[model samples]
Target: MNRKAFTLIELIFVILLIGVLSAVAVPKFIGMRDNAKITSELSTAASVQTALEACHGEWVINDAPFVCGNGIRSDSADFNATTGYPVTLGSGDDTPLDKILKNGATVHWKKSGENYYGPASDPQNGTSRCIEGKPCIGKCWRYDSAEGTLKLQTSGC
Candidate 1:
């Protein structure tokens, strides 16, 4: 007639403790995940910037060739003459920025009155600016061809 089962009160207490712990930990874990994403995006942006500079240097060394690899010398049909960068993310065969930032993150472009975004089935054009230095998530990596600048937004992330 000996029973080794735990009491109902003990089981309830254990369940309550688990619930409390989970409630405290879930949000922290989510925040951590978001922070990680932001950090990764920043790193990608830095790498792309470095690559862009290198490409520009090469372009300079070659006496500013009109066409090299996927880069155009002047403001060609697809690239910008001022910065020698692509006008849009995927407009040309394979832009220098594209080769550097391939598959890293979606690249958004900003032109005079036209805008183009990538990785979206129906990318909106000229609707909004992507590199406004705002804190955002999922929309990481913005390339301003006009100024030849690449930025990573992570405030909302």
Candidate 2:
């Protein structure tokens, strides 16, 4: 009586165990994927911020006020026209978040405040609350029209 291989019952049990483990791992993997997407989008936002600072530098150097708040010129050297920002770093349009979602990149962008830029869905967990629902300055960001700077809210989520 040599037990040469796993019995059918043992095979079934192992299969079931693997199935259960996979089921548990899959959701976590999906969540991580979504979080990674969100993090990349946030990085795009930071890029936009850097471009904006450069635009301000141009203004300081008497180059004129290039557009801010969205993408930069596809070629920064071509920022002379009144069309908008240059066109080197990024497109002169909505923020990168907007570009990703609107261009059907399998992600979406919404904001806690009117001016804030992030995902409409919960960025961190994707199941928690999305927007804080307070006004821009109160909850997400503040546009100091006088200083022309975007001030993150005290919460600064």
Candidate 3:
């Protein structure tokens, strides 16, 4: 005969156990935030396809002759003496695909026309050829810089 409160069936069983634990933790936190954004867009398309096959195998070990666009090895890095890759899948900064996968091609990408890609709703008619992927729930990771590809489209999530 001395208790003072909480007995409306223990406040409706603690508000029905906090609405059943927020309805089972909000769809498992929105399915773990869409599986951590498709595992960070599949680890940024496998580190920009291993830095576009190590800058096209260092432009076929530099014997591919002349103009690596910026890099030979000391890492100014931009490749493409006619298909060593990265004349533009744009990683920004100075472009030409971030001069060797800098920032791992920055996930959920963007930049549309000049051809830095991923997550562009539409603006890409400038053409560098091979920009088809449009779907990581935000899409755009299919960059084929002269056959040094990087794919992770995931069909619109």
lDDT score, candidate 3, position 156 = 36
The model with the greatest TM-score is 1
Clashing pairs in 1: 66-73, 135-155, 135-156
Per-residue accuracy of model 1 over 1-157 as CA lDDT, tens digit each: 7979989999999999999999999999877654554455456556667766665665556554454334333435555655565554443333324434555334543333323332211133321223345224335444566666765444321
Local error of candidate 2 at residue 119 (angstroms): 8.1
Model 2: residues with Cα > 4 Å off, grouped in runs: 58-157
Measure candidate 3: CA RMSD: 12.2
* Candidate that scores best on lDDT: 3
The positional error of residue 67 in candidate 1, measured at the CA in angstroms, is 5.7
Per-prediction TM-score, please? 0.52, 0.43, 0.37
Worst 10 residues of 1 by lDDT: 119-128
Please list the C-alpha lDDT of all candidates, in the order they appear: 0.50, 0.43, 0.53
- The per-prediction CA RMSD against the true structure, in angstroms, equals 7.0, 8.8, 12.2
Q: What overall lDDT, based on C-alpha atoms, would model 3 receive against the true structure?
A: 0.53
